[model samples]
Target: MKKRGLAGEFVAHLFPRVVRGENLRLTYTFCLGGLALTVFLLLLVSGVLLLFYYQPTTAGAFSSILFLEEQVPGGKYLRSLHRMASHLFLILLFLHSLRVLLTGAYRPPRQLNWLIGFALLGLAIFDGYTGYLLPMDQLALWATQTGMELLGTIPGGTLVKDFLLPDGIGGSLSLLRFYALHIVVLPLAMGVLIVLHFYRIRRDKGILPYL
Candidate 1:
């Protein structure tokens, strides 16, 4: 047999050669993790498309969104798809986490994968929150301000708030920071965590058998 190349080996590692028959049942896993991943992919594509038109500035952010919705063809649908997928991704992650917990899938060798999954969920939530401020609308402005205030109330969270909003609130610098985090930093981190999560799952012998 020909030895697989690096790309082929990586693909094989992700796809795996064997899946137990019991794991095929829908009720066993509810496919929540798979669904979340699908939504993440959707969000990625739509977000990239949106990036072509989005402006990362307090002065132009909301105007650019309006231009996309009213001037760009099919832009409204693309934005809506991304927004809906973001919401669905979070929901699916929560349900998947609950399923893992109830099934005791986090026990033993699966613990590391569980931690990775938890971190991915957190990144997803923060990604959504960061995106919330990119539009620079009144709702987004007040909501982010409220969140920043709440963060200041927590121990050590004030430092985080300061780091994120160094120039007070709702300015060009803060909007740019949120835009960078939403579009670049958070997604890249989540992507890395997802790869590690999958590798851990395979190493741990796949998902736990149904009870």
Candidate 2:
């Protein structure tokens, strides 16, 4: 209990001072950013809960999802929350960026944070797309194949697609690859980027005021 209390204190201490001050307020300053973070935390929890029953194989992927929806306790609710939270996170992230842009907070030292924010947004979108394919349902399979074909239209797109789907779309290799990225690689990158984003905000003394 003592250790838990210490950890809580450490996390509490990590919050940027600007969040504690009413004087630093803007119309959408804390609301959008805080909501984005909150929704992401929900996604993380629900995603972890999902992993216990999820199978990443071509044959088992869709069946596992159905099992989750119809069999496991609270599985349907968790899946629903995960799906909705994914969509909501993107919306709130975009609004957060819009708020920064409208406030001209992207100036000077904050420019790097803006770039990082954009990267995080792109990764967030890609994260959602990759997770969408984990079910291996008809919509998921065709949507992913269509996306790959679209990628193939670009220069070197075939090479990229070959690398991603070396065993071809709808194959076990493709499913495994997407599963790894969805559950591991992309989330790790996002976690690093989020830490740096908040660290910069605290380092810069807070979000910049209007120009």
Candidate 3:
């Protein structure tokens, strides 16, 4: 006696007719993934708001951030929230990953999902790094130069660093590249991976019941 409508079916698929350990208390079961997802959602909201005022140009980047903090209403709060959320998101995800490892949830049918989670972690870190450069302050400039130097130390990474920082660290081109990746490519990739990660969890019968 399942209902049969497009929207209903979609919702049903997401919620599902059954889940493992449904009778157990939620706090007693695994919920780190959900916590990580919530923090990521917060980051998304704050990041979108920040996009309205952030300037990607090397010359304007720092000034734009300063103006936001000093002039725009609630801008300082939003920026701080965004930055804090970035750190919290990573922390939660790391805990989630560690929980998975400690609970044996990364085995067998769940290995692929673990890999997807790792992909998300990598993308999130890269996104954070790119954001770090958007402010174009002296600290950001030095940090960016150090990052590029580290990248150059890799065998084939010099080409990528050159292409991304053609005019060197703190250059307009590098700033623009980081801005695009921060605001566009990495976010999109992470979004897709997140969807896949959750889908796999739902399909694989949730978080394996915390051992």
Q: Pick the candidate with the highest lDDT.
A: 1
> Which pairs, if any, clash in model 3?
none
Which of 2 and 3 is ahead in lDDT? 2
* lDDT accuracy of residue 54 in candidate 2: 94
The residue ranges of model 2 lying beyond 4 angstroms of the native Cα positions read 1-26, 208-211
Q: Candidate 3's residue-wise lDDT over 106-164, tens digit each?
A: 99888999999988998998898888889988888888888878888999989988888
Off by over 4 Å in 3: 1-30, 208-211
The number of residue pairs in model 3 that clash at the backbone is 0
TM-score of each predicted structure versus truth: 0.90, 0.86, 0.86
TM-score of 2: 0.86
| Model 2 CA lDDT for position 186 | 95
Cα lDDT listed for each candidate:
0.84, 0.82, 0.81
Best by TM-score: 1
